[model samples]
Every structure is written in structure tokens, then in C-alpha cells.
Target: MQSNRGTPLTPSQAASPHAAAVADSSVTRSASQQALILAGVCIAVLVLPLNFGGAAVSAPTIGTALRGSPVAINWILNAFMLSFGSSLMVAGALADLLGRKRVFAVGVALFAATSLGISAAPSLVWVDFLRALQGIAAALVLAGSSAALAQEFDGHGRARAFSMLGTTFGVGLALGPLLAGFLTQTFGWRSFFLADAAIGLTGFALGVPKLRESYDPHANGLDWPGAISFTAALTLFTFGLLQGPESGWSSPLIVALFVGAAVMAIAFVWIEGRVTRPMLDLSLFRYPRFVGVQVLPLATAFCYVTLLLVLPTRFIGIEGHTAIGAGLMMVSLSAPMLFVPLTAAHLTRWMSAGVISAIGLVIAAIGMLWFSGIGFDASATVLAIPLFVIGVGAGLPWGLMDGLSVSVVPKERAGMATGIFSTTRVAGEGMTLAVASAILAVLTRLRLADALPGSPDASAHAVTEAAQRVATGDLAHAAAFLPALGQPVLVHAYDGAFRVLLHMLVAITLASAIMVLGFLGRTPSPTSRDPASPTLS
Candidate 1:
């Protein structure tokens, strides 16, 4: 009776039911608030991946409608990715210093606004501008929302919450192509943007009010120098690659870009080493398992994400498949993303994650080789086998990598581990895609030159333009530029150029697999979890 005030009482110890009833009400209220917070963040997360997968499928349609150069069309995708990838670490740092909820709400609002703006864009330039802005907003939304979600749960609850978040991202990627294809095929490309805009607005309304504000007490101020240097470095590097095929690789402009890129990269490394709370925690790279964790995403970028754009272009641009038909075929490539992760999670019962990842990559390499032999005459069912195999192979490591990201490092370093992994995963995709695009364009240009009619009518200028057009998935317009060779010859040239790129991807992917296996061989599995530490499974 002297100290019952702060204690939860048994039924017999309670003087009246009123006190117990009040305590029960407080518990109920706390549970209700948690549900609201989870709902808001998950809804916002869905639209970001949706754009990645959706926009890839819509490329051919967007190209035809927007009437831009192959370079210009390529910019549409790279512009978004570059801004998003380069901005993520900075955005995360800012979220920690300011408030997670504040950044998250603003991000959602800006994302919604940009989506709406892209929907009504009159030209590719407008779309490109808005898409880059959308990417920055996307980084803010992702960084803040995930951190906020982590703050609300602990241990098993935290793992489960993040698992749900991962699955939501999976669902978006799984459904993006099909949904975008349907909308584009039925109405127009603009409809896809409009649909995403509606989804973004709904997320904003649901999440903004329920989200609680929080900040990292230990976070130092933002690293402005590191952010600027890193962004500039990547921008210069990507520009050099993209413009190399058009402007002679030895051109003064191209050389300057490359040199600038190298200088900025060195500056970024210097800045990170000196910063109190660095944008990149360079110390983590010293660990072999942590290094391997980084390799996994770069491998996937080459094998899986790069194909999302390439396959859609081949199906709709060159082979004349309808958007709906291409979308249906893409199900073979992307649908495994939805379920294979679950299957791979169970495989850990028999094998190490590294073994499983390496084996998966080997399988993808084989599938890519098989795809190199496929031609336009092959039936859809026959075509899908290689693509499906690639999908399953990629899915195995995809499931395990998220957990490995945090678990590979010590508990105190988990946040930094996650930031590095997320940045690598995203930035890897952008840089890889840009490089792949350059190779495809450059190779296609050479092949087209060889296939040219060797008459005065077929000039080198014409060959370059046609090849650029073809690289961007515009076989019809590309064919128009080189009428002497006929469309058949142009298509064949494109096919030959493409097979070489596929072989290159196969080699790089297998090499990365070996690196991951060697590096992750000795790292131990996490045995115990702290209830207060944030993590994902």
C-alpha cells in the first residue's frame, strides 16, 4: 500500500477496477500510435521502387512520345538515379541532425508534387528536370522514413518491421512493369506518372500526421564538403562515360571530364577521412565480410537491374512487342523477386550465405550466355526460360544481403553499415547502368559502321545517330536514318552488338561472385540480438 502508485497491481491488490482500467487504456493508446507510424512510412516507401521498375518498361513509349535523342532519353533515367544516389548519404545525415519526421513529410510532399509535374510535362527536358528533383525528394523520404520506422521498434519487432518494409519494396518492383505497361498501353505513358502521383499523395496524407519526430543525439553536423565532392565526382565520371561514344573518347572535353572526376574523387576521400562524423565510414571497408557485403549489390546491379531497361527496349523497340506483351514477358524476369527471397532465406539451413550467393550468381551467368543465343524468331515461352533462370539466380542473394548489411559490422556501427550499403546498392545501379549504356552505344556504333552500305549516302555521322537511336530502343527511327541497309541488317547489327555486352556482363558477374565467396567465407552469423539495437532480417 505504501508503494503501489508506480507499480502495476494484481487484481487482488487493486483497491478499485478504475485504476487498472486506466492503465489498460494507456497501453491500448500506445499500441494504436505504433500502428499509425508503421502504416505511414510503408505507404511512402512503395512508390520509390515503383518508379525504378515502371520507368524502365515505359522507356520505349516515352522515347516515341517525347522525340528526344538517344542521349537525351538515357538522361531521363540516369538523371534521376544520379541525383537520388548522390544525395542519399547527405539526406540521411540531415535527417539525423534535424528531425526524421520533418524531412520525411517534406520528402513525401515534394515527391507527390514532382510526380504530378512529370505527368503533365510537354517535353523530355521538362521530364528530365522534374525527375532529377523527384530523386532528391525520394532520397529524403527513404532515409527519414526508414530511420523513423527503426526508432519505433526493437529486436524481433524491429526485424519484422524492416522485413515488411523490404517486402513492400519487392511488391513494388514485382508489380511496376505490369502496372506501367497496362497504363501506357491502354491510355498513354503520362498515365503511369499520374497513377504514381495519386499513390504518393495518399501516402503523404496518411503518414505526415501520425509520424513522430526524432533525431540522433550523437550525430555531428552535416558533411557539406564530402557531399559536394562525392556528387561532383560521380557526375563528372558518368558524363565522361555517356559522352565518350558521341564525342571522340580522346576529345578535349571528354578528357577534362575524366580528369575532373579523378580529382574530385581524391578530394572526397580526403574530406571523409577528416570529417568528425564522416559521410562514409572508411574503417568498415577494412573488414573482409563488410567488403563482400558491398560487392553483392554491385554484382546484382550488373546482372539484374541493368537488364530491366535492356530487355524492355529489346522487346518493344526492336522486336515490336506491345507494351502489354512486353510486360507479360517481364513477369518471367521480375516475378521471382517476390518469392525467391523467401525460398533463399530457408536455404540457409543447409549452406552458408556466401555459398548460396556465389551459386546464384553462377546460375545467372549461365542464363545470360543462353540468352545470347536467342533471336527474334524464338517463341515467348522459349525466351522466358533464360530470363526466368536469371531472375531466380539473382533472387537468392537479394534476400540475404539486407540482413548481412547490418550484421557484418559491430552493433555500434550498424547505422553506418546500413548507410554505406544503401548508398552502394543504389549508387552501384546508377554507375553500372551508365557504364553499360555507354558500352552498348559505342559497340553498336562500330557494328553499324561495319554494316553500312559503304556508299556516299551512308556517312559516319548517320551511322552514329542511328546507333544512338537503336541503343535507346528506337529501331524504327534508327532504321530511318540508314535506309540503304534495310531494317533487317540494322536489327542484326544491333543483335550482334548486344550479344557482346551480354557476354561482358556474364564475365563481370561471375568474377564478383568469386570475390564475395572468398571475402565472406570466415564471417560468423549473428548469435544474439539486443532489444534496443535497430536491425533488419
Candidate 2:
């Protein structure tokens, strides 16, 4: 009305104040939208790792339902990890080249659909296949989601955001077994998949409209050769590991897989050097700090996976705990992770990143050693101290390592960086499971042979195979199959196998501590602009 009526109002005269108001409203709206997107991303991240720990507890149940052997049950976990780890770098490249939001949405949708497929699967084969597909979807989601977050945040904002992510990760891991036990016992193993599907669908719906798009304009072309070779190398290596103990370490098939893995690994290295736009920047390894940080995740995953497999098995098989009770016991191992990350910064006042990380590894190793000292009849109460210590050690370096690993790289390559980091973590998990399982199986068989000397070779083998079920905490089902007289022998053999596992874990964790002390360089502060001297804080 004023513009129309009076004084032939100048262009700025009528619009300046209104423009400022509109701009303020837009800024506020954008911030709100960012908040929504962050919430969605955190939700997705929490759910993904939850599946890892939850499936650890539920694998025996799934194996029973599908009439799967222990080897086949291993594949249930491996199939997902193999596909997920293999495809992460490729998915990251795709996110950089295409759009993060688009890829993330697609991933969420695929995950939702695949969850339904897994829930309805008729056979173990179908379940494995579906799990593989879900892994692919997970790769996409993880790459896109993290990249998107990196793009939107910077400085203190980024630190806080990633810290929150770390906390959420711990929460998911901590609660996963409890949720899995409750759901599986009340409804069925299928209920977890159904819940996963529902969560995925919710994320998908929220992502499509709420999440903004991001892409790296300078990203290079996709590296198909690198992708193929890397995938082949990892798959072959994992296959060899999985088959080594089951088929005999000297088996032709296992030997061939190992050879194939070596060849594929060489090819991958060759391809990465030649590619114009390499999926992985080989130069990143030039920095000892980066290399050390990358390996830290692997070490963390190794310890975590070991406990994830061992604790539940011990609780259920030896202590005669229900699934829920076993899960409750795991709380001592996982709960500390929730609170320790927030206080990790306090350690910076007295120690450098490398020293802190090395100390953490040493502490974790001590925990493993302590836990291993307990006898077969030890109670959960006796186990709590070491479990809590291990959890604290893991939590201390969780967010710090992740933040430091990616800090050396420019923001533009966050997708690739995140992918590589994630690959190492999951691959460490898969490799540990494959190798540890092989060791456990071989040793368990040998222990069974020793325990039941007069039994027929076939009889011992049969019972040993059944003992694998008992060792993994499926005591109820395994007891149904074995004779009463042999039950004690089976349990004894299983306990001995667990001891072997614990010893191996002690050595592995010690090695990790040694590596951190030897290789991890000092990282610079956030205020530091020096490229040559990087510090983790």
C-alpha cells in the first residue's frame, strides 16, 4: 500500500527491510532442515551397526532355523561383510560423481526391500543372497551419508557432529544384542529383519525430501579396474580363510583361493597406480599418521569382533544363560563406549594422539588377558571388570581415531576417505571371524579327539561338529543331538577351544599395541596449519 500510494518510492526504500526479514527466515529454515537431515543420518548410522552386533547373537538361531552347519552360519555373517566391504570404495566414488542424497535415498530403499526379502527367505541360500544385497545397499548408504555430513559441516560443527555419530555408534552396538534377544525370543529372528525394514523405510522417506544434495564437482571418472581387482582380492582371501580349517589348510581349493587372492591383490595395486582417477589415493599412505589411523580401526574391530563372538557363546554355552541373559552380560563390555568418547579430549592435555592410542590398545590387551585367566566355571560377576575395561579402551579412541584419519585429506575427498576407513574396519571384522573361526574349529576338533579317545573316528567327528553348535551358545539344540555321556566331553572341548581363542586374542591385541607405538605419528591441533606435522587432537 505504501509503495503504491506515496512519493514514487525508490527501489530500496520499500524493499530493504522486507528483504532482510526474508533472508533471516531463509537462514532459520535452512538450519532447521539441516537439523532434520542430521537426525535422519544419525538414525541410519545407529541402525546399521546395530545389525552387526545383533546378528552375532542371532546367528545360531538362524542356523537352527535353516538347518545350517557352523560353516554355513559363518557365511551368513561373512556374506554381508564381504559385499559391504568390497563395494564401499566404489559406492563412495559413485557418491562423489553423482549426488549424495540421491545415492543415500536409493540405498535406504534397497535396504528396506532387501530386509523384507531376508525376512521372507525360504532357504539359507536365499538369506545369504539377500544379505549380500543388503551389504551393497549398506555401502551406498554409509558412503553417501557420511559424505553428505562432511559437506554440510565444518570446524567445531563437524567435530560435534562426528562426536554425536560416535556416541550413537556406541549406543547401537551396546543395545543391539539386548534388542535382538528380546525380539527373537518374543517373536522370531525374522522380527529383527522386519524392524530393520521399517527403520530403512522411515529413513528413506525422510531422506528424499529433507536431505539436501551434494557432489564433488572435481571428482574423476569411476575406477572400474581398481574396483574389480580389489573386490576379487578381498573375496578370494576371505574364501581361503573360511575354507582353510574346514577343508584342510592343505586342500587344493583353499590353496587356489590363496593364490588367486595374491594375484588379484597385485593386480589391484597395479590398476590403482594406472587409473587416471584412482578410487583410492595411494599417496595417502605416504603419511605414516594416516596409515596408523587406518590400522587403528582394524585393531579396534578385531578386538570387538572377538568379544562379540566369545562372550555370548560363553554365557549361553557354559553359564546356561538365556539369550537375553547373555545379552545383558554383554552390557558390561559395551556400556562404557557410550560415555568415554565424550571425555577423550581430556586425555589430550597430558598425551599425544599416538601415545593415547597405544595406551588404549595396551589397556584393551590387558583386559583380554585378564578375561582369559578366568576358569570355565567363572560367573558373569567376575567377568564384569575386564569387560568394562575393554569397553573403555575401545571407546577412548573411537571418535578420535576416526576424526584424525580423515583430517589430513581435504574436505573434497571425504567420500573416498570414509570408504577406505570403513573398508578396513569391516574387513578386519570379517578376516578375524574367518581366521578365528578356522582356528576354533580346528582346535575344537583336535580337543574333542583328545577327550574321547576310544570313540570311533566318525563318531568323534560327528560329535565335534555338533560341539561347534554348543560352543556357539546353542546348548539347547546341541544337547538334543548329543548323548548324555558325551555332553560333558563336548562342553569341555568347547571350553578348551574358547581358551585357545582367548590366547589368540591376547596376542593379536598385543600386536596392535606394538603397531600403534611403532607407527602412529603425532597429529597436529585444529589450529595448526602445518601439513607436515599433523596431530590427532
Candidate 3:
């Protein structure tokens, strides 16, 4: 039953050792029952983060109570993302080595405990530390859940399972803000962390009985060096990108950090090639379809994050919508996510993954183009259409690409493949935001220069400061200039930003389309089993 390439199962067979252990027992439930249980666990794990954004308004109050600086407040949020992103590969590798169910249970316990700590922390430093712990817990849950899903189902069942996972993720992203708002408005910001604790505990209780051990006993030992090097490289690179805008891009510290990151990355590649128990096998890119599938998520995530950053400011700052109203308007951006998984599953019955991905990219490109036309006077409803379209575009690719990537590989390597795919998606999103913001900054300065001529010192300084403020979305400072010059300068800067974002979307979409068409030729028949399956591999 071992697959040749490294996927655990063919998407049609069970890869869990527990499945075999229970195969002869008359006490086993039907496949549908097991799937439902697994899906419920996935949803429970995902709901932990749903209230994050809503807590944004309450962060200041929390910060004051904890005696933390504004910088500490930022860390409280960023710590989660950084830890979550950096620990993914490590979590996945551990799961493949130690068994998924055991590691997953451990993660759930840690997550619940850390959430409680975060909720009760008396100082900013404690809160930030707990948040990083919570993020590590999240990485464990996410990595284990994904690999387990791939192990438990194959073929159309696999498609449905992947769709369910995507749906769970989408729900989390959409509800996070709404839940945060309600909890913060009523019980205070601490309720958000409390909620995460509750959810994590619930998942642990359910998963203990239903989740089964899934791991290849033949898997290699942990590659600690590779893991450390990879984590350090990604962390340094992300830190440099995030700080470059604020610290001055040409600063010695920033330049040195990037250089260090580059060196670490090169060393990581070299180490992986020689290590017997590599954390990530660079050889996976040899499969053209696998490579193509990876690119779709990278491109999609890049555009998705950019849109999320750009749109709300356009609504509230330019159109004068209240914060709550702007948030409501942005709901359209996530609405399509609700239906995309089911839609993608149905479409996969007839369409190849490549075709589906290409179509999605085209839809996303069109949406980006539509968004570019938005101006200072645009109505909320007018913006919703493109936002919804963008959501639809983003929704389909996540599940489709994820399913395809795992499906193409052999079962034994499923964990590594999943980890790599996830890492690329996060890296793409971070890089996209940084790159797009940099471009917008440059364009805004040029426009500012053109608008404020005849006074070189004033014009140069004003343009530089304005560009920085806009990149950071400092509306107060941006509004200060509106009184001095007519609002035309601000409007032009916004327009330039939007235009550049649109072109980026188009270029990325086109690249994604080409990759899909040229590399992902067709969906292979769902017959081959993944060699990574515990029993088979």
C-alpha cells in the first residue's frame, strides 16, 4: 500500500495505525461518522483565533492595565504570528516522528494552559511571552490537524475533508473580529484569551477519544540543525522586513540582519541536502505539479493579505465611514469564503486542479482591477462586489492547492510536503505586504513631489514624511496635511497606491496561471497510495 512518491495515502485509504488496530473490532463507526468527528475537531482548533482582530480596540486598555509600552502592545499581536509561522515545519516534522495524535494532544493542552496565562497576565512582558507560547501551540495543532486529515481520507473523501478544513479556517478568519468585538465590548479583552482556552480544552477532550495515532514508524529522526537554521533564517528575514520600514531601510542594523538571513538560508539548503533526517527535502520541487500547486497558494496569499491591508483604510479614511461601519462593509471580503470550499469540492468532480486554480486567479485579477477603480467618493456597496469576488478567488485556491500538493506526493513525505507548502504561503504573504507597501511608499513620494513643486526642501521632506505616514496608515498625520494643501495630494497618493497594488495583482495572477497551465498538467487518477502512511510506508 506504500505510495512511490511519499504521500501517506492516495486520498482514498486510511493512513492511521489506529485504523488498522480498530479494523477488526466490531465497535468501529462508519467512515462518515469518523469524518464528522475529525471535522469537528478541526473546527474547534480553528475557532481559537477567531476573536483576535476584535481585540484590537481593547488592546490599549489592556496595555495600560499591564503597564506596557505601545511597542509591547504590538509584540503581543506579532508574537503569535511569528511563532506560529516559524514553528510550522518543526511541528510537522515532530508529528511524523512521534505520532500525530500524541503530539496533537500535547499541543491542545499547552495551548489551553498558555491561553489562561495570557488572559490573567499582570504585565506586558508576561502577556507577550504567553502569546508566543500560544502561537507555538497553534502551530502544533495546525500542523497535526492537516497531516491527520490527509491520513484519514483519500479520493473524493479526501477532497471533502480538505474542503471542511478550509471551511473551518475561513470561519475562523471571518468570526475572529466579530467575536473579539463582542467579547471586548462586554466582558473586556481578556475574554478573548479565555475564549481560546475554552475552545482548546474542548478540542482536547473530543480529540483524545476520536483522534488516532498516525505516523510512519520508519520515519527518520528529527533534524534539529536543519530546523534551527530554517527557523532562524525565516525569523531574521521576517524581522528585517517588518522593521525596515520603521528603522530606515538603509540602516546598518537592518542591512546586517538581511545579510545574516541570506547566509543562514544558504546554509540551511546545504545542510538539508546532506542530512539523512532532513527537516525539509528540497527534492520535492522535482515534481512539476507539486511546485505549481505551491505557487498558487503563495500568489493567492500575497494578494489576499494586500487587499486586507489596503481596503479598510480606503473605506474609513477616504469615505468617512465610522470604524464599525467600515468593518461591516469589509464583511463582504470574507463572505465568499463561506461557500468556496463546497464550491471547489463540487468543481473538482469535473475540472482538474490546474484549471480550477487558473480560473480562480483570473477571477482574483478581475477583482483587483475593479478595486483599483475605487476613489475617494466610492460608496460602501460599490466596494463590496470586488471584495466578494476577491474572497471567492482566495477561497478556492487554498483547499484545492493544499489537497493537490499532498495528493501528488507519497504518504511518507506528507508531513514535510505540508510543512513546506504552509511555510511558503506564510512567507509569500509577509513578503507581499512588505513589497507592496514599499512600492506604494515610493509611488506616493513621486506623486507628492509632483504635487508640491517650487520648494525643494519642503517638498522633499513633506513627500518623505507623507509616504511613511501613509504606509503605516497614520490617518491623523495624513489629515493634518489636508488643511494645508487641498485634499488632492492625499487623494493622489491613495490612487497611486491602489494602482500599484492592482498591477501587482495582475502580474501575480498571470504568473500563477502560467505555472498552473505549464506545470500542473492534469489531475492524476486517485489510485496510487502515499508511501508515507504509517502501515504502508
Candidate 4:
């Protein structure tokens, strides 16, 4: 029988053979629907993080193979983040307006096609183009599929479903580094894309047909003007950050981009207020739970997600660890995600989820500080403890975020809620990743400005070039540019920049902990999953 919490049952319940077919057909049907969602989403969860963690590990190799510059190297990663992050809000709202099954199928199909194209691309330009395109597909998959999963489960079941989601994400991340290392070392980085295509298509084939169509009856057509303005704002701001260091922060072009981004952001907010059906409902931000949920992903973006890119490159490119070795080292960072999220979920019975999240952030802050103390001199064994600690802290909020996202809002608005929270998480990651790269480059340049032996103008240009290469883990190229002192000087300069980055992360994590606790600590936790429930209480 269907539970009192209203677990969705399949229409074709009579087809199920479980529980003697006649008895509790609803139970069998509910099982079937949950199985479909879990299968599809689990497949997607596996492949998506592979692209993230695997691709980061593959970056230095890709740069060397493609003969890419520092700008080119960073863009390969940021292009995906920018396009994927900025598009999520619209994708979520789109799912609510259109059919969730339709959006999801299109996303997975597009993913397979793009992965194929990326694998065959001969240049960084083509690769970057495809990666950005892939982000759009990723946005669709995340929004459509996650919302579908949210629709099928409720109460304890809903919590469990999302916990599984977090755990699957962890599995992918944990495995991504090692898998990327092996593929890049043996078959080449391009093979990783080949793997993505195969796994994604298999998931598509298995899961799409099982998912039923869903749409919010109350949703009007998408607010196109708001969508466009929001995307433009995000794209412009990210581009400005990426271009600032190289173009001169005050360059007319960079300055214009920042100004345009600010104008567009304001326009988006204005348009949302006036629209009868806004793409992003501005009214949702009034609720503290809504704001608190958003902060969870944003914090993870800084403390955990950025490291997925930063550390892989640092280990393989500068520290001289093999791709496989770096992968093994990263397992410490990725493993907690596998188990800690469930532990966090179970803990909610005794403690407020908000308090749990706050404690986790504190732990992550401590890990970041411990991590920063180590230099290139440290071994993988020495690095493991800190990496594991960081992962443990991040996993707590990761476990609860998806479940809380749906519980805080009306059931009909799951898609929009998913989008807003995801957009903040990803857009923040992309923009922060861009900003962090630029800041590191600038800091590295300043450190080397006086050390180079050339005349003022020549030295200025050399330092700038050297810093770019150093920031991307291209030490050989950087050494070539600065012949006076070689690799040691480059390594020393990078360490200084990295230290500053760690300090920023620690400070931000601590503040985020405080912000989230204040916003959500008093809010009641959801005890029973109500299909139509809006607030946790």
C-alpha cells in the first residue's frame, strides 16, 4: 500500500509482479518508480563528477598535448562552469514549464553527442566550445532528473533518496581522479570523454523511458526576459573576472564588461518583480530556509569544489606526482562524501540540520588551515588527513541541502527551488574559480616583478607571462620564460599565492557557518515528508 506520505505510484501498477501482484500493487508501483529515478540519476551522478574531477586531473596533460597558453588552459575548465552555472536557473524553471521527462532526455542525448565531439576535437578552441555546450546539457540533466526524483519520494523516503544522491555524487568524485589519471596516462585525456559518452548514453537508455512527464499546472510560460538578463549578468561578470588580470583591470573592455554585468543584474531583479510569472520568483528569498539552503552549496563551492580543480593540477603538474598518485591522494578528499552525508541525515533526529551544517563548516575551516600548512615538501600520506577532514565537513551540508531545498518551498515549485539553489552553487563555483585564478595570477606576478633580470618593460611582460604559466601548473614553460632562476623561483612564487587563497577560503567558510546558523537554526526540521507541504513545520 502507498504510505500516508503520498509516495507516487506508477500508473502501470498491474504490471508489477512483486508482492503477489494483487496484494499491495501500490507498494510495487512505488518501488518501480523510485527504482527508475534512482537508476537514471545515479548514472548521471557518476558521469558528471567524472567530467569535473577527471577533467581537472587531465588539464595539465591537455595543455601540454594541445600546446595551450595559461588563458587557454583555464578557459577549458571555466567555460564549462560559466555556461553550466549560468544556465541552471532557466533549466529548472524550464522543467516546470515544459515536461521534466522531455528536458531530461534532451540533456542526456546532448551530453553523449558533445562528449563524442570533444573526444575528437583537435584544438583547445574546439574543446572549450564543446565543454561550454556540454554545461548546458548538464544543467538540463541536473534540473529535470533531480526534480523528478524529488517528485517520487517523501518524508523519510525523500531524505533517503537525496542522501543516496549525495552519496552517488561522492562515488563519482572519489573515483574520478584515479580513473582520469589512468585514462590520461595510458589512452590519453580524450578517452575520458569517450567514457563519459558511453556511460551517459547507457543511463539515458535505461532511465528516460521509466520517468513520467511532469509539469507545474500553476506555472505560466517561462519569463524569457528575466532568463536572458540573468544569463547575461552571469556571463559578463565571469568574463570580466577572467580577462581582468591580462587585459589590465582598468582596461576599457574589462571595465565595460563589469559595468554591463552590474546593469544586467539589476535589470534581471527589476524584470522579475514586474513579471506576472517570473522565471525566478523573488518572493522565495523572503524565507530564511531558502536563503540558508543556498548558502550550503555556495560554501561548498569555495571550500571543496574549487579544490577539485586546484589540487589535481597542483599535485600532477607542480609537485611531480603521477596522475594515478594524485588520484589516490584525492580519495581522502572524496571518500567522506560517500558516507558522511547519510550520517548527517540520521543525526537530524536529534539535532537541528542547521546546527549540523554549522558544525560541518567549522570542521572544513579547520581542514583548510591544516591543508595550507603543508608545502610541496609534503607527501601524499601527510596530505591525506587534512583532505579527509575537509571532505567530512563538506559532506554534512551536502547531505541535507537537496532534501531541505524541496521542503522549504511548495511542492509544485520544486523545479524552481532546485534551480535557484543549484545556480547559486554552480555560478558561484564558476565565478569564484575564475576570480581565484585571476587573483592567483596577479599575486604570482607581483611576487616575481622585481626578481627578473630584464629591463623594466621587458621584465613587466616576462613576469606577467611567467605568472600565468605558473598559475596553471605549467612550470616548464614558466621556467623557460624566467631563465635567471628556473623552476625553484616559480615554485616559491606559486606557494605564496596558494597560501593567500587558503586564508580567503578559511575566512569565508567561518562566516558562512555563522550566516547559515542564524538564517535556519530556528526553523523546524521536516519530520514527515508531505507531498504538498511547503514549509518544514
- Sorting all predicted structures by TM-score, with the top scorer first, yields 1, 4, 2, 3
Name the lDDT value of residue 274 in candidate 3.
Answer: 100
Per-residue alpha-carbon lDDT of model 4 for 230-285, expressed as tens digits? 88998899888877777788999999999999999999999989977666667778
Mind giving the per-residue lDDT tens digits that candidate 2 earns over 1-537?
Answer: 011111111111111111110011122336677677677777765567677777766776787688766666777788888888787777766665677777777888888888899889888888888888988888787766755655555455655665566566778778888887778777988888888888777766655576656655455467788888988998898888766655667779999999999999899888878866676667667767667777777777666666875566567655666668777778888787777655665665666666677777778878877887887677778888888888888666664665555564554333345446666776667777777777777777777656555867667546656655665555655566556436676677777887778777777777887887676646642122111110111
Clashing pairs in 1: none
Q: Considering summed lDDT, which 10 consecutive residues are worst modelled in model 1? A: 9-18
Task: State each model's CA lDDT, in order.
Answer: 0.77, 0.67, 0.62, 0.76
Ranking by lDDT: 1, 4, 2, 3
TM value for model 2: 0.87
Error of 2 at 260 (Å): 1.2
Q: Pick the candidate with the highest lDDT.
A: 1
Specify the highest-TM-score model's number.
1
Candidate 4 residue spans exceeding 4 A from truth: 1-37, 150-163, 217-220, 406-415, 453-455, 526-537
Instruction: For residue 41, give model 3's deviation from the true position in Å.
Output: 1.6
Off by over 4 Å in 3: 1-40, 48-79, 113-131, 147-163, 181-191, 209-216, 309-323, 407-415, 437-469, 477-495, 521-537
Q: Is candidate 1 or candidate 2 better by lDDT?
A: 1
- Residues 323-410, model 3: lDDT tens digits: 4565566567765666674576567668776777777877888887787777757777887888788888876665466566677777
